[model samples]
Target: MAGQGSGGNVIAAICNIFFPGLGQLVQGRILAALIFAILFFGGAALWFLIVPAIIAGIVYIWAIIDAAKYKGP
Candidate 1:
């Protein structure tokens, strides 16, 4: 269980890193994913600073938590 959760978290983190909210989508959090995607991408387009990257990192952490708690397909 721990391994599975950790793996899911890693995947979610990676997905979120590449495409914000993608990890949430994978975990069945479609609305949240869409929102994050819009905000993340929009921010990236508007501001190319370290802030977006930091936000991505924070989202990735959230993804890890979500992944750890996920129990569905």
Candidate 2:
């Protein structure tokens, strides 16, 4: 069930690697995409601080994993 070929979810996750919410947008999860986009870009905007940068990195990675693992209609 998981890790089945290069399916849409896989593609989504790959897209997320480049931009945190891109995968969600591709998957048609508009709200989730918006949240991810806001957090990612908001944090990125304040990435001058070390803490914000680290947090943004963590959120980015989480978004990637979430996109890869999401299972739903």
Q: What TM-score fits each model?
A: 0.57, 0.85
At residue 11, candidate 2 shows an lDDT of 93
- Cα RMSD of all models vs. native, in order, equals 4.1, 2.5
Candidate 1 structure, TM-score to reference = 0.57
**lDDT, each prediction:** 0.66, 0.84
Model 1 agreement with the true structure over 16-59: per-residue lDDT tens digits: 76667887786667987887777666655645687876776565
lDDT of prediction 2? 0.84
lDDT of 1: 0.66
Please list the residue runs of candidate 1 whose C-alpha ends up more than 4 Å from where it truly belongs after superposition: 1-4, 48-73
Cα lDDT tens digits, model 2, 1-73, are: 2443448789999999988999988888899998888888888889888787788888899889888888865
- Tell me, by TM-score, which candidate is best: 2
- Give the winner by lDDT: 2
